[model samples]
Target: MSFSPAAAHPRYDALLAEWCDLLRRCQEPGADGAPAPDPEPYGRDLLGRWGESQRKYHTLDHLQAVLDRATELTAYAADPDTVALAAWFHDAVYRPDRSENEERSAHLAERALPEAGVGAGRTAEVARLVRLTVTHDPAGDDHDGEVLCDADLAVLAGDPAAYAAYAAAVRAEYGFVPDDAFRTGRAAVLRQLLDLPALFRTPYGKEQWERTARRNLTTELELLTA
Candidate 1:
């Protein structure tokens, strides 16, 4: 399929146009624009620099998955602009070697938004929300962040069959690992997910993601143990 902003998200067609215009203006040299970088190039560069496993984890498909969920939860979001920005930049810079990939991604967003005329304060808030994806902790005041994180993780809570396919895809991305080590690590990760109080924290996420997530976790865990 062609990568049309209209095709992937009909609802955001207008918003996509607006965003593109904004990006293009920013791209213009010395046109009173603050010289903002093209986010698409940033996305491309990040993916291009990634190792195999990180590439799969931070793939365009994963971004699309999170963006889809973020769109669904946007109706209930009070500050959807912040949520959407967080969704776009949350995984902007992913480095598997470091535990601070979220922090770095947030930093990139912080730097990029101000140049694009998004106020510094609002940019910081969005960056905070992007960082919050790492913790995936739900708080009364952080409903939007929770929803975004849940959406980011929805693949884990998706249908068992699909989740199994995702797991295999992930394993393939990490094909360097031995079969026994991969099975052990994968099972451990699934168990950790099963141990969480709830797969999705926000009301919307809980309603939409809990069952499938649990099913996926359980199936994987059983397969690992057996």
Candidate 2:
């Protein structure tokens, strides 16, 4: 299940529709009276909220990147819904101060997924995937978590120009700071990324993105320092 960036949006919209239909099918008649809101509008609302957040370097594009990679990786794997749901909600609450972004995002998804027709067990799996993105650490790993983390970091392993664009977009999202602060902070992030044992933890990630990601990081680090 390889995805072209052009076609991914429609594919995702169709998936959202199916998820909404599942909710409607499982609903008790008149439970909420009128009728369920249209899934397109509801999905748009979620995406819009994500877009408008001031602290969004990890915006819809970022989510899409993860989903695209997850789709490719999961082609040879299983439980695609867990990866899909995680991609949608992993960055739902995007505050910079808290280190618990993943936990909060997972909580938001846990509440939202049940309302959107996901089962309790699957919701837990989605939450697990969300947590996986918090740190690229792969020890004591689950297969799904590894896939999700690799997908999240795939941006770093993209083509150099695209990777640089992503790096700039990330800095722009946090552009309230002074130039010096942004430079220092951005440099630190690249250094930390360089310090990683491997940017893509899973074999699929390694195969597809490991080299490109390292190239992007090293190039950016040199540019940032000089």
Candidate 3:
């Protein structure tokens, strides 16, 4: 809830605090006035998944960044808290080698949220937003989708050094692929992103992030092709 939550992650107390805040916003108060259900267990479970040994780019640090970005863009969302829920579950089932991570992550949210006190509509919304990450292309009027998509992709607009680190981390994640194959695949992905009319849909993202992200993606693409 605070501005300093930028560093709030699984290893720190702030992440747990942040999750509880999100839970409170989406879940109705317990029968009468009792406190909302505890959200820490689910948060902890997801944190453990993020901290898995195979991860390099899709780690707890990435989750923290997405959550932080979603917080920054909260004003653009029709339901900011619901977007945050999506952030937590977006990579909950990440496995660099897997093709269905998004679907699996969405399923995890669908099964877990209702039991965690989130209403059906919000639960489905969270799952839908998680699935959206597969493309990161939200419709023009989809404010909540825009927020979550932009937040997940904000890393692309980072400073050169940060972008370099992100690129390196990604290569590390797909280490199993042969060098030539990885380069070709990576270049294609970059080209697809470059082909988009705009890499970011949110106004702030379009204005503040678009140019830099395009530059970064182009640079990466060239490197891969070269």
Candidate 4:
């Protein structure tokens, strides 16, 4: 079902307002004299997508959390607005059973951002940031991408109760898969994260989240393997 404002997320209104302001700032006057596109419809569409029935973890709350973290790390971002926009659309096309969710979400950003008046260069940057979430491995020089990726992963460093809830929500999202298969797949993903040279790319992220994230991932991996 589509998201209705009244029944939708608690943060939906604030997020919509924030997007509207961001899009308005990014809008360029049309060459043909067409009015600048409205951000309200675009924001509403994204909220509806995030509010879809199948999404248990990739909801507005997750988006808000990422945006909050991105805001906190704005000093490290080349383009803070682009990072925030990327966070908005990174999981916009989520499908728990699909491996191409990040790619599809990036494509969605490419298609929709221009219509919302985001410039071509900035839109491409946003799409690149969204795609980077697939591996959470931004290029060494990509400051904005690193911030966005780290923000998206900040939940891994949350306190134990919050981390447990995050895990539960993820499991709920993949409820279509059998428990045995889900556990196996999840453990593999955790192991891969643990095997990474660094769980977070930015100095801020490394200092603030790396150790806690590794601890949480190791603990969860053990449970999954057990």
Candidate 5:
């Protein structure tokens, strides 16, 4: 699915609604029988962060893409709700020039989810899942992690035109970097992805995305090096 930059905020409300529903499921009941704290504000905060000027690829469009893929592969996740939460926070603290974005985003999830009434275990799981995006390398048996990691990478499997658009968006995000520096850095990242034994961890992701992802990566690498 292609995303228009103009529609980002409108689309965020739908994603936020889905997140609120998931948050409600993960909520623990209050001792006095009160409902758990609402997560809409937190969702809005995250959406706002994703809409920042420094972000071009890691916008609401990217979040929605990952969330949609996670929902489609929900049957493969051990905890779909946690995976969904992780998706919301995965790029929450993005900075195109920064290396610690994943760690920072995970920290944000750790700090925010529990206060909003998510259980400790679930909160930890969400943070862990967010951190896994730093490598996109989940353990073989970690189903939820696999699902989340694959979802984050699902854009690699898009059609050629969509993949081209994604590459342009990413380049735009790093517009601060000089052409030579950007090419070297971007090429290194693509090569690392190419070197991975498998790009998609979950069976569903492997079946649906692996080949196309490799093709897209190879195509981009050629353009970068050419």
Candidate 6:
């Protein structure tokens, strides 16, 4: 995606520090204990990707929100740092018109994480978690997946105004689509999410967000159809 000056996030420094800290925890020293590569460049690249112009909803602000939510949900994740990393790469390759953005983002994680000195297993887990964003239907026992998915979806539980703004921003991202088509696709998405047995897997998420998110999705779906 192309760079967008206006989409730049205000908390770049804080976000970078967050990324660097997470990366440092995951890094494995080189042969003979050589230090891992600096995490700043990788954090900068990810920040740039999140700020890409074609995005409206998937901006750096969204990234920071997800990161914060993921951190909040770490109590449910078996590997909190890995969940943090997954949060960083989850939408790193977002494109409104592209269906394979999740896979590509996962691939990007697969390639980048190991080079950043993360262990192979953690890198693979990170990529798997990124791909899971496609369905956001993590199995019951998938702790990390549950946290990542819940964090990614926490925006749905926002108050009416924030939720409305989120809907508008999403519409703006797919501006290339005709109004009718966008409504149809967006309605289907809401229905799919609504059809799930449970929207949020973690105990805190279920108690805090599930009902609100369902209400929001139902309202959005009704509006889209109306």
Clashing pairs in 1: 157-213
- TM-score versus the correct structure, for each prediction: 0.75, 0.78, 0.92, 0.96, 0.93, 0.96
lDDT string for model 5 (143-215, tens) is 9989998998999999999999999999999999999999999999999999999999888889989999999
lDDT of each: 0.68, 0.70, 0.88, 0.88, 0.88, 0.92
Residue clash pairs of candidate 6: none
**Over the full model, what C-alpha lDDT does candidate 2 score relative to the true structure?**
0.70
Q: Candidate 2 lDDT, tens digit per residue, 1-226? A: 3333323444556545654554454333335565544455446555654565575567666766777788888864457667766777788777665569889988887887667555678888888888877677756357777777777888887676787788878777777777788788888888887888877767777887888888888888788788
Model 4, position 89, has a per-residue lDDT of 91
Top lDDT hit: 6
Checking candidate 3 for backbone clashes, the offending pairs are none
Order of candidate numbers by lDDT, starting with the best? 6, 4, 5, 3, 2, 1
Q: What residue pairs clash in candidate 5, if any at all?
A: none
Task: Quote the lDDT for 224 in model 6.
Answer: 87
Per-residue lDDT tens digits for candidate 4, residues 108-165, read 9999988877789999988888989988887899899889989999999999999999
Q: Using TM-score as the measure, what is the rank order of every candidate, best first?
A: 6, 4, 5, 3, 2, 1
Candidate 3 lDDT by residue in tens digits, 171-191: 999999999999998998898
TM-score of 1: 0.75
101-208: candidate 6 lDDT, tens digit per residue: 999999999999988999899999999999999999999999999999999999999999999999999999999999999999999999999998999999999999
Candidate 2 has its poorest 10 consecutive residues by lDDT at 1-10
Residue 153 error for model 1, in Å? 1.6
Deviating ranges (above 4 Å) for candidate 3: 1-11, 29-36
